[model samples]
Target: MTRELARRDGLFGPIRVLERKHDGARLYCINGSLQTLMLADGVSAFGYVHAAKILVAEAPNVLIIGGAGGSLATMLATRGHSVTVIDIDPAAEQIARDFFNLPPQVRWVTADPLHFITAQEGVFDAVIVDACDSSGIVSPFDKPGVIADLLMKACPRGSLVVNIVAEDGAPPWGGWLAAKLASLGLSVCLFRSEEGWEGNEILHVRVDGPTDRLAITDLEQRPPEARTYLMSLRPHVASHVPVPATSDNGAS
Candidate 1:
């Protein structure tokens, strides 16, 4: 009962709509030999859009991993923030351009985020983690101190956020991962949706300020209905997962 819808957006090379869902239509990029799956309306691109919408300031340097339909990238560009998005899937980049109307201010890099983060030296005002494994895993590349160190080293007195998929009340990584990051001196905050699509976590790591003073209420402020939607996706804060540690520069 599923089929590919034809292209309509001229800006995007070749795009298609898979089907209509509760939130929006599932989208894809059909320009190349490979079919790149894009967004799932209310669900697939929801987390990034919500998070991006509440960003406190316009950042000159920003890095995004797992450009989901380019929602976050587009939103940031519209707000006058320079964005660089890295995705392992070229199809994803095309789909984001074609279907989500991602703008050119959002530079694109087709590469693995882990490798790129390790190899780069540019410090950013913000770093976003939206990477996902094909097997439905979210960033299994854990070395405890690497993420904190990277953000601290690369960001200039700014913040970093990572999205996770878990149930409400789930202890993401049994609280070990978050704790490790905190021990390294990054202010942390957790955000979730009521719909339970994917457990979203927004961890704010401060570079040159008191970590405890960083306020999360601003970025997370939402209307009752919106809060309801956010609460729906709250991963169980106590849920534990097997986060593997990498040695010698985070290479598998």
Candidate 2:
């Protein structure tokens, strides 16, 4: 069972907050796509977010290029990582605070990600590209050149994690993206559900990190649930060769 907690027209389209009665999990949906899910205590409820967290656990500073419900930012901030989230929609920040319980410590920047990346001065230890809208990955992020620029400008020596939604067990652009980034001298890894493409596919790319394995740092500090989820994920280095593009999955 679920209840509609709030709804409003947002820049992307209709934005909504919904609560699941059984688990008290809150969902933030934009343009009919489920962007975030948070537990009652404000922890991320998505497995892919937890997986991404593990990939960046060693990094001290993190930049997330999409706000959504701010779950990823909140999770990182609570873990003592400095986190900044940039989104084009100001309403995303407001709704995240108003309904998703986004904490005050996470810095919120309302701007186009491409513009922010070009003008930003400070470098982050890790950068996550999770930007998307109703159709799919928003503007320039869908293109490889923009992502390459983001790496050059904001995270020259850090990690870049991208969240890709998949359909029928494969991401439309994951294989190609992995190959592209790898060609630029970055080690790339892909993480997906063992059960198949039931959720988001996470791509972890790094300039100087090992591609062989993912290690969970400060494991003792993680909550029992987070520890379990983190330990369950399997990550493998992405192929340097690009796979044929699959049909686009509208949104998730």
Task: Encode model 2's per-residue lDDT on 65-138: one tens digit a residue.
Answer: 88889988988888899999998886888898898878898889999877887788789988999875433355
In candidate 2, position 177 carries an lDDT of: 71
RMSD of each: 6.8, 4.1
Q: Highest lDDT: which candidate?
A: 2
Query: Which pairs of residues have clashing backbones in candidate 2?
Result: none
Which numbered prediction scores highest in TM-score against the true structure? Answer: 2
Stretches of candidate 2 above 4 Å error?
133-136, 169-171, 216-232, 240-252
Stretches off by above 4 angstroms in model 1 are 1-3, 6-24, 27-48, 56-58, 133-137, 168-171, 192-198, 208-227, 230-252
Candidate 2 yields a Cα-based lDDT of 0.75
Query: What's the C-alpha lDDT at position 137 in model 2?
Result: 51
lDDT string for model 1 (1-252, tens) is 446655444232444546445534455543431222234432234543455445435466788776746766766777688889987765566767665677877899988776777788676788776653322225443445656766766665676666554444443442455555555555654444546334444544555453322223542543332444544433322223444333332312
Model 1 accuracy (lDDT, Cα):
0.54
Clashes of 2: 0
